[model samples]
Target: MSRKEQIEKTATALFKSKGFSATSMRDLANALGIEAASIYSHIKSKEEILQRVCFNMAREFFEAIDAVEAKEGNATDRLKRAIAAHVNVLTQNTEASAVFLHEWRHLSEPMHGTYLSLRDKYEARFREIIRSGMNNGEFTVPDEKFAALTILSSLNWIHTWYKPEGKMTPAEIAHNLTEMLLNGLTSSKQALHDTYSHLNTP
Candidate 1:
C-alpha cells in the first residue's frame, strides 16, 4: 500500500477506537512508526481524515441503496437486498464504517449540516420502501417511520459485534436479520398452537 493509504488505514482504526476528537496526529503517526509532522504531507488535518472516512462510507451506502432500488423485485425482495448490502458494507469495512457511524458528530460547520441532510435523505429511502410494501399488501406496520427506524437500528447494531472470524458470514447475518424482521421468530410448530388467538379475533 501507498504511504498515504497506510496512514489512512491506521487513522481509521484510531478513529474507531478513540473517536475522531480523541485521536491525534501523534497517535496516528506513532501507530505507523513515523514522525507526526510527516503525515501532513498527505493529510491536511484530522477532520480531513474523518471526512474521508465518513463520506466514503456514506457514498458506499448510497450506492448500495441505489443499486437495490433499481433492481426488478418485489418490496420484500428489495428490502432483503437492502439489508444484505448494508451488512456486507459494514462487515467488509468495519473500522472505517464504525467511524462513519459513531464519529461523524465531530465534523465541522457546513460539512456537519451536509452530512445530516445526506443521512436524512438516506433514511427517507427506507421509509419509501416500507411504504411501498404496505401499498402492495406485502408488509403490515402501524407506522412507516417506526418500521424503517427499527430495521435500521437493528442493522446498524450489527457493526458493534460482527467479526470476520464469527460463525455467520455477512450474507447469512443479513438473511437471519431479514427473516427476523419480516417473518419473526415464531417457529411453525409454535405458531400452530394459536396461543395468542385472542389477538387475531375479530
Candidate 2:
C-alpha cells in the first residue's frame, strides 16, 4: 500500500482501539513505525484521518443500500440482501467499521453534523424498506420506525464482538440474522409445532 493508505489503515486501527479522543498522532506514528512529523507529510491532521475512515464507511453503507434498491425484488428479499450487505461491509472492514461506529463522536463541527445527517439518511433507507414490507403485507410490524431501529441496532454492533476467524461466515450470519429479525423466534417455533401437530393427525 502507498504511505497515505498505510497511514489511514494504521490510524483506523488505533482509533478503533484507543478511541479518537484518546489516540494521538504519535500513537498512530508509532503504529506506522515512522516519526510523528512524517505523518503530516502524507496527511494534514488526525482529524483528517478520522474523516477518511468515517466517510468511507458511510459511503460503503449508502452504496450497499443503493445496490439493494436497484435490484428487482420484493421488500423481504431486498431487506435480506440489505442485511447481508451490511454484515459483509462490517466484517470485511472491521477496523474502519469500529471507528465509524464508536469514534465518530470525536469529529469536529461541520464533520460531526455531516456524519449525523449521513447516518440519518442511512437509517431512513432501512425504515423505508420496513415500511414497504408492511404495506405489501410481507411484514406485520406495529411500528415501522421502531422495527427498523431495532434491526439496525442489532446489526450495527457486530464489529464489537465479531471475530474474523469465527466458524460462521459473514453471509451465514447475515442470513440467520435476517431470518430471526424478519420472522421472530417464537413465531418460528410456533410454526414448527403447528406443522408437527398437523402431520401427526390421524
Candidate 3:
C-alpha cells in the first residue's frame, strides 16, 4: 500500500480499538514508526480519515443493497438478500466496519450532519423493504418502523462480537440470522412457530 493508504488503514485500526476521541495523530504516526508531523503531509486531520472510513463503508452498504433490491424476487427474498449483504459488509472488514458503525459520532459539523442524513436514508431503505413485505402480505409486523429498527439493531450488533475465525462463516451467520428474523416477521403464525422452534435447536 502507498503511504496514504497505510496511514488510513492504521487510522481505522486505531479508531476501532482506541476510539476517535482517544486516538491522536501522533499515536497514529507512532504506530507507523514515523514523526508526528509527517502524517500531516497525507492527512489534513484525523476526522478526514473518519469521514473516509464511515462514508466508504456506507457506500458498500448502498451498493450491496441496491443490487439486492433490484433483483427479481418477492419482498421476503429481497430482505433475505439485504440481510446477507449487510452481514457480508460487516464481516468483510470488521475493523473498518466497527469504526464505521461506532465511531462516526466523532465527526465534525457538516460532515456529521451529512453522515446523519446518509444514516437515516440508509435505515429508511431498510424500512422500505419491511414495508414492502407488509404490503404484499408476506410480513405481519404491527409497526414496520419498530420492526425495522429491531431487525437492524440485531444485525448491527453482530460486529461487536463477530470473529472471522469463529465457528460460523459469514454466510452461515447471515442465513441463520435471516431465518430467525424472518420467522418473526412471517405472516403465518404456524409457520413462524415451527421455523422459530427449529431455529432454537442446537
Top lDDT prediction, candidate number: 3
Better of 2 and 3 by lDDT: 3
lDDT pick, better of 1 and 2: 2
Mind giving the per-residue lDDT tens digits that candidate 1 earns over 1-202?
A: 9998899899999998888888989999899999999999999998998888889999999999999998999888888998899888889888988898888899998999989999999899988988888787777677888888888888997878999999999999999999998773124324554757857788
User: Could you tell me every candidate's TM-score relative to the true structure?
Assistant: 0.90, 0.89, 0.91
- Ten-residue segment with the worst summed lDDT in candidate 1? 184-193
Clashing pairs in 1: none
Please state the error at residue 149 of candidate 3 in Å. Answer: 1.0
State each model's C-alpha RMSD to the native.
3.6, 4.1, 5.4
Give residue 182's error in model 2 in angstroms. 0.7
Most TM-score-accurate candidate: 3
Model 3 worst lDDT window (10 residues): 185-194
Off by over 4 Å in 3: 187-202
For all candidates, what are the clash counts? 0, 0, 0
Model 2 off-target regions past 4 Å?
185-202
lDDT tens per residue, model 2, 145-199:
8888889899989898889798899998998898888885135445767999999
Ranking by lDDT: 3, 2, 1
Q: Per-residue lDDT for 1-202 in model 3, tens only?
A: 9999999999999999999999988899999999999999998999999999999999999999999988999888989999999999999999999999899889889989999998888889889989998897889888888888888899998888899899999999999999999988874646766899999999
